[model samples]
Target: MRESEYAESRADFVHQLRIAIKEANETQYWLELLHQADYINKKVLNQLIKTVLKS
Candidate 1:
């Protein structure tokens, strides 16, 4: 995700941003799954969700 900040061109920036957003979405899905399965606490899940979507 940090790579997008230093992208050399607009195309590269967009590409990196898209990849980061996709990965963040995937992470959110997994986190939701874990929370639903009782693998993580609500507080922790909320924190993770906030961090993942902070951009």
Candidate 2:
């Protein structure tokens, strides 16, 4: 997130936003995987998903 703070150009800012969105999607994928595998509890999973989506 801080990477965008120092962006020197509009292109750089767009790049950073794209990267952040990709990473967030990837995080959601992993979180769902863990939940489906029974490696995470419902309460914790819900909290994590909420936090990720909010961000």
Candidate 3:
């Protein structure tokens, strides 16, 4: 293969890799946010239970 063709192919590969990495990072962020929200909800529920028991 020609040098220019090889370089273009390599550039395309790099671009695709960058896009994949970005998508993976975004997915991880969403998962972490979901986990944090779940934890907060549990804490709120516990607080509500404690308040009710004290009443």
> Against the true structure, whose lDDT is highest?
1
Clashes of each: 0, 0, 0
- Which pairs of residues collide in model 1? none
Instruction: Give the Å shift of residue 51 in candidate 2.
Output: 2.1
Q: What digit string (tens of lDDT, one per residue) describes model 1 on residues 1-55? A: 8999999999999999999999999999999999999999999999999999995
Instruction: Residues 1-55, candidate 2: write the lDDT tens digits.
Output: 6798889999999999889889889998999899999999889889998998787
Q: After superposition, which runs of candidate 1 have C-alpha atoms over 4 Å from their true positions?
A: none
Per-residue CA lDDT of model 3 for 1-55, tens digit only, reads 1223344577876776666566656655555565577854655655654553343
Each prediction's RMSD over C-alphas, in Å, is 1.3, 1.2, 16.7
Q: What is the descending lDDT order?
A: 1, 2, 3
User: Once superposed on the true structure, which residue ranges of model 3 sit more than 4 Å away at CA?
Assistant: 1-8, 39-55
Supply the global lDDT for candidate 1. Answer: 0.96
- Would you estimate the TM-scores of all the predictions? 0.85, 0.86, 0.55
lDDT by candidate, in order shown:
0.96, 0.90, 0.55
Q: What is the lDDT of residue 30 in candidate 2?
A: 95
| List of clashing residue pairs for candidate 3 | none
